[model samples]
Target chain A: MQNHKTLWQIFAAPILIGVLSSIGLIAALVGDGWWDGISWLTLALPVLLYFFFVLRRRRVNS
Target chain B: MLLLCITGLPLIFHHEIDDLLHAEVKPAEVAPGTPMADLDKLLANAMAKSPGQVPHFLIWDRDDPNAMFVSVGPTITANPVNNRLVRMDAHTGDYLDSPDVTGRFTYIMLKLHTDMFAGLPGKLFLGLMGILFCVAIISGIVVYAPSMRKLDFGSYRSHRPRIVRWLDVHNLAGILLVMWTVVVGFTGVINTWADLVLKMWQFGQLAEMTAQYKDREVPTKLTSLNSAVEVAAHAVPGMTPSFVAFPGTIFTSKSHYAVFLRGETPVTSRLLKPALIDAETGKLTDSRDMPWYVSTLFISQPLHFGDYGGMPLKILWAILDVLTIIVLGTGVYLWLRRRKTGVSTVRAIAQTSAVEAPLASS
Candidate 1:
């Protein structure tokens, strides 16, 4: 397994996604259209990623 | 606190549940370009229903287009418990349901979620709890970072010891839900302070807005409510009147009516534009954007309530809420389990001998 780390992993990703989720929540409340789309995607990102990884690993192992 | 989250999950889906439980009979569809039922007629009906009482608020539901809810009270500053609420067909002026039964239960859930049946002190106490919860989440993140550096994101070490595995699960879920927890928690804290904030506005901006009319008498022979609405609409172009606050209400002065208008877009819709009207003349007195303090509270509501993106977003909110409950439960579990074995009789004995032996040697 690769042990290398990057700046994005250490700093950018967490902070960016964290801020994005907040924006998405606020925007969704502001009204609709693209705001709603952004809300759906950002809010769903984490759990979606978790499942994505889990299913991919299962398939590979099987 | 656990009870708060459990109760809050139902509240996230409160719209669906409330609609289903207290469904009003929809008014029959009218022809295109049909004029709305007269506001004056509805006001009269509301007054007739509650003799001697005055109308506090007239709320038109934008989503339903033909539904409305009105609150009538004995006084302008009457506590919610003292108000009589009625829902009606806005287009037809027909009483769909009067003497609300479901409203009490819904309000109880809100009060419980808000202050646990206590008032301001309860609100302030919950605000402190929210701050502490935020602190816990922050400290958890700090402690979690080093472990995270070693493992990939979403790592849950099933093969590890029970506590360690739990720690991993806790970290993953907590981090994933961190944005939500912070937003909800922070907004919740703001909401707990909403009453105080509104009072501050009343003392400051509202006072200034109504300053000119302070000496005026309570308006008795008022102008038409429809005209007041029209004046407010004209004052704010491209926006629709959301509600009307009658004279002598806290929302307005003793001699003026306050017509609250909302914009079509999302951001402006939450931000109310209030136009003060001359109660006797049906003429606009002053109109301007509400101060930031009041608007901030208004904006915090939907963010806290998750009422934006319909069913899907609410479902997402519920899921995150459940995940947070798990994280919180596991945290308490780990702490109690460690305390039972690590900090009790065996550690006490070890500590005793260690202290005694060191003293004796010295």
Candidate 2:
């Protein structure tokens, strides 16, 4: 069996993404204009990541 | 949880859908500096159309500055839940069509999303489910660690068996959406307590604010609604009126008009401060920032609705919602698959991570 990954290795990306998502959620609530833009970008990260991995896997398989 | 997600999908675009489905009377276009029509005139026009119905609330349409809505019910003491909204042009005081929105598609979706057509008990039950959903997300996170012990983040084994692939998808999606699901879910739970929270405000802060006039009867003659609004605005300098709860409504005392004013900042805009005006005298009775619980409800509203950040954010919200649906779908599939094979969830997760384990055929 492959060496077991540390908890940090497993959770590092998720924790970062969670922090970004949190910032995104609160950004738009603080103000509009650039604040809203920041929110849109930050909140879009996970969704973008999801698509990236899924489509990448599909492309690799094909 | 699945029902909440499915119903919530359409609600994310409820406004856009309502605009497309319903033929609404558009407010007339006017110059930027054009003064808003007198609130009294607007109230008069609205009441003229609704005859015996009493106005419970006057609301400024958040999306449309040129239009306002007067919520009217059959009687002063009647429940405002079934109130008819009379849309009036802000500049001209013209009566716009008040379509029976309760019969609309978006309205139906909203009813289902909120309470499953089961009233407060339904709302609380759904809230209980939301609590469980939150707990599930947390426990999912805990199990996620063990599942990922042998796999990298975002690892999708496309060549694996259906169950294994699905387990990966569930883990990937669920972990990625942890913050969003928890925030949205917890906020939804908070939103379920909105009615109760409003009741608490009424009995707590609202009652305290109007204690001196507790025994006062509903005013026989109401002062000019326009002046009362002006009084409220002047009382609270930096904030603008969000809505006005008319005299004898649940939001205010029988003898007062509760003008709920909001600030200019996005955050403060959600946090409303009420300036109660004497209905008979057209003077500010009391003005105070809403208590913490009420403020929490207000803040939770936009967070749950995903309406605060404009179109792009709403689109993102829809996508995230869809991702959540996938996570839920895969989760159920994994559970059923485990049940069929008589394998524990943790064991399945652990086995799926180990490539040397014998491939389990579907």
Candidate 3:
């Protein structure tokens, strides 16, 4: 189980990231105007959050 | 890591270099009726002086007073190597000496960065390398997930092996640049097939051009290509001409001349482009903004390369590229080390007595 991650934890980051990215992409298609401003941040947030959560879990266990 | 570092460094400053080398000239109002014959006469006399060539495309100064450019190639070849752009007076046929294209550092950098002079084959090869780079980045992330399980996002456990130090750097770079690398990699793959993309765009997006001219009066009358060009300037004010596609060429219809315009701002910069002019009357009949896919390609260009922002952005790009190179080196190193260790473990097991070996190994 050392390498195993719970289903929720494993899927959480990707799902959240996917949703944000999808919003940005749809906003881009629809000319939402505001999405253009924060599009990069939207794309990066999920990946960063995933890293943060995983690192936090590791530190607590150690 | 090494590859990332090198490419990242150049990617960071590509825009800066572009800005440093060229000054923008916005087009000024010339008489709508500026005779194209004058521009053509100037170019014709200039080309005749050169040993052997015919013109391919003509470029006009978008902003300068009395400036035009003629890009020519040997009349008989499709090869781009023979192509040359001759700058000339727009109103007079006075030839401006061709800028020294050879021996320029920018040209050398572009050649190495794009194709390494092997041309298509080299581009295809580099594209494959870009894929390998993508794979290395992905795998580096996979390995890092396990090691960083207990550390903070930027935490470096210095007490670990030299390989670990390198691995942490590799992981951080790969993770940070995951999206960027994918975009650049995919785009680089598409660019390797540049000729195909242009052909596809011509036939797909501008299918209207072909249909429009099919029944129209053909502009076969040699109305100095430059005249149609000036006519376009009259129609589209503040538009600087980049390249012109002639009638009967694959890029245009029999009745229209196509002129590409360059954009002026950081965001509009990549999107500045093609306007269609009536070949016969020198009227700006129609124009094309970049399609979605092409626009995506354009915007992705700066993000993927990290070249749009100023010097600070460039430094960031360089750091990221170096990190990618390190990731690649560490990946290769890790693979080799794993293989060696596997072999030693097998040897040690084989040398032990049967019961003891099995027990010890377990």
Candidate 4:
């Protein structure tokens, strides 16, 4: 394992995902059409990321 | 909490489930701009169908504008909680079918999800649990920081022992879904207080609005329901009638018909404004936006249900709900494993960050 990372480094991805999820939650509530599309894309990020990480086999040499 | 998640999963697709499970009369297909049948005629048809039942509320179906619902109970003063909904055609003023929805799968799931068949106290208890769930999520975030310090985000050490692997899954899913889980969970808690909030509105704002009519007895000769809604529509420009609470029901005073109107936009559609029409004269008495608390409850509903954005959003909600179930399951497993080894979860997580040692050796 590498040396201890800063709090920002540890939280960067989570904070980003959280903000995007919040946007997704409110976007569809505000309007329709493109708003709904935007919400679907933003909200799908975490679910997609979850599957990508859990299913992808890690490289051995890295 | 597991029960809540499991029950809530199917509820995300409740409309589709209900359609698949039950057969009912369909509204006749009508061309565009076909003027709806008069509200009075529709009410009369529904009343004729259900003998000895008194109408409590007339509701316009949000999903199916071609049909409307009349909620009726045994008596005017009876609790509207168990009132039956009679479906009527919007354009023809003909009684369709009144399916007893209490026995449906979705209804049972909803009852379990909301109150577990225990009424108000059960709802309040679930709300308290929801609050606790929110607190746990917040605390989980704090604990996540140290555990993730040495590992990259989304790092799942698949080769590690079961306990360590699950801890990673829990952390990854938990962190990613922080916003959604908290919003849905807390909004669910807000929904539990709906009964109390309506009671507050009835006594506070509704009372103040109709205080002048407090002394008047419920009109023996009620005016036309059609005109009351028409007056309400005129009073609230650019809005459509959502539902009307008949006089002598829990939602209105004894002498005024409360016509609730909704806006056209997506956001405004959820927020309702009530226009009180004098039941005797069928004239507009008063109109006002709902108080903030009631408005909050209304806004929180869609956020919790994930029904606002159509089918795709509902599917996403179901997936996220399943992920949450996994999170909850892993959390329980971790706790049980920790107890077996006699180590607190926080310290175990802290130790994992330092040396990457497996917590459970199998």
Candidate number achieving the greatest DockQ relative to the actual structure = 2
CAPRI grade, predicted model 3 = incorrect
Give DockQ per model, in order: 0.36, 0.86, 0.11, 0.71
Comparing 2 and 3 on lDDT, the stronger one: 2
lDDT (tens digit, per residue) of candidate 3 on A1-62? 14555445443443455566545333332332454445545544534553564465457656
State each model's CA lDDT, in order. 0.77, 0.92, 0.59, 0.93
Q: What TM-score does candidate 4 get on C-alpha atoms? A: 0.96
lDDT of 4 at B200: 99
Question: Which candidate has the highest TM-score of all?
Answer: 2
Candidate 4 deviant stretches above 4 angstroms: A58-62, B345-362
Pick out the ten consecutive residues of candidate 4 chain A with the lowest summed lDDT: A53-62
lDDT at B156, model 4: 86
Global lDDT of model 1: 0.77
**Where is model 4 chain B poorest over a 10-residue stretch in terms of lDDT?**
B353-362
By lDDT, who's the top model here? Answer: 4
Tens digits of per-residue lDDT for model 2 on B156-271? 88876687788888998899889999999999999999999999999999999999999999998999889988988998898899999988999999999999999998889899
lDDT of 1 by residue, B1-362 (tens): 68778889888977667777776677768876777889889777667667777788788886787777787887776775457777767877776666565345566677788888788888899888988988898897776665566567766655434666566667777777788888888888888898898788778877898788789987769899888898889888999888888788777888888999988776677788889999988888888787887888888877888877877788888888888898898788777766887774324434555776677689
Q: Count the backbone clashes (under 3 Å) in each candidate.
A: 1, 0, 17, 0
